[model samples]
Target: MQVEVLSCMRHPNMVLLLGACPEYGCLVYEYMANGSLDDCLFRRGKSPALPWQLRFRIAAEIATGLNFLHQAKPKPLVHRDLKPGNILLDRNFVSKISDVGLARLVPPTVADTVTQYRMTSTAGTFCYIDPEYQQTGMLGIKSDVYSLGIMLLQIITAKPPMGLTHQVGRSIEDGTFHEILDPAIEDWPLEHAMHFAKLALQCAEMRKKDRPDLGKVLLPELNKLRDFAEENLPMMMMFGAGFAPRNNNTYSNSAFSSSTFQVSIIFSKQQPYFFSLY
Candidate 1:
């Protein structure tokens, strides 16, 4: 299932599947030097904490990949499992969505305005799974949005997701939103972070219908934060105390276009299956 889904999809922010051996059920992918966002966020390898700018950039990149998956042709795919561990980072710290093994292709329906599927079982990480989908078998693209919200909050707070929404909500209500931000990042832009926090809370809403549209509303706001990060990269470097910006290529808005992604497949007698990534 992973091969079938990955072989058909291409996006800059998505992990590139190099090859697969169906006989062994093994899949190979491009090596990510920086490992997963889980590692970076928690400094698992004694690595420095991620700068606010980088965190914002990664949030936007993950959103871009997830949006691509939801907007896939023929059928939109829902990534049932979306968490920090599944998000990888390249040498340049470019975030990419990985581990689509639990992804499902939502069956299209003409009568319904919102697309969803009824499943017998729910699959995803605790705290990260959509509450509505977990209780009910009905899964939709918004399920992924709920996970994304948890991720966004984690990116900001650098804390575990368990009961995190309520914590942030209380902090906001008590006029302590800044206090809830990750202490590792000492210089959070309070107003911008407040706006971001509000959005995250909306996405984490228990009701799926209450969530904002990922592509239409969420993506645009995240993109603004991405651009804000880019524009302030120099300042962050100078004032961010031990923070260093990478030499990554400037993020291209045109990357959302299908023309920017290309998939090439190869068949051979010896190899079970292969996909070439440029």
Candidate 2:
């Protein structure tokens, strides 16, 4: 049954299955060179911290991929397990959802599945697991949303979801959001930080219905983040104290007149200066 489902599935964002061995119960998939988000985020001395914009992009990509799975035809694929460890990244930093081992296919007509997948073994990491799913045996798309929300929080704050001293509920209520943010991202723009934080909060809502669907929630937040990055290009470049032009072709008068180009040049100088500080 798992093999049949894997064979039928096809999506640009999803991890493509190359082949499966029935005898060995193994599946081959397109390799993600960057490995899992967990490796980069949690592992030490791997690379400098992932920038907020890149983090948002990865989050958005994962959301879109999951949305495609949920809305797939014939039946929506329910990834009962989703966490940073399951999110694989390519060399270019494009993220793909992998490890469908715990996935459940929900047929449109059936509405829900009755096969009763056991939850005693811990379906997902402790921090990323939905509170509702932990309490109730019922597993659905909302479970994935909850996990994504946790991951969004992780990206913005740069901290593991569960390891903080305070409880998630208390920290949220006490307005100590900064306490949860990752220390490495010390100078993250207030606006971008707040935006992603709020979105994460909404996704982590105790009530399932209160949370926005992946389409409504993740995509819009990601778009806004992208726009923010574009707008700040000049500032980033300017901080670097002028960058060496990679291409000889200079901007035309018409191109210079455009807002994006203007923003680009404004920050171009800062690019070289910005990196020197580090």
Among these predicted structures, which one has the highest TM-score? Answer: 1
C-alpha TM-score for every candidate:
0.84, 0.72
Tell me each candidate's RMSD, in Å, in order: 6.4, 13.8
RMSD of 2: 13.8
Candidate 1, superposed: residue stretches over 4 Å from native: 110-112, 235-278
Q: Please give the range of 10 consecutive residues that has the lowest summed lDDT in model 2.
A: 269-278
Relative to the true structure, candidate 1 has a C-alpha RMSD (angstroms) of: 6.4
Candidates' C-alpha lDDT: 0.80, 0.62
How well does candidate 2 score on lDDT at residue 43?
52
lDDT of 1 by residue, 23-61 (tens): 656676777778899999998979988888888888888
Query: Model 1 reaches what TM-score against the true structure?
Result: 0.84
Error of 1 at 16 (Å): 0.1
Best candidate according to lDDT: 1
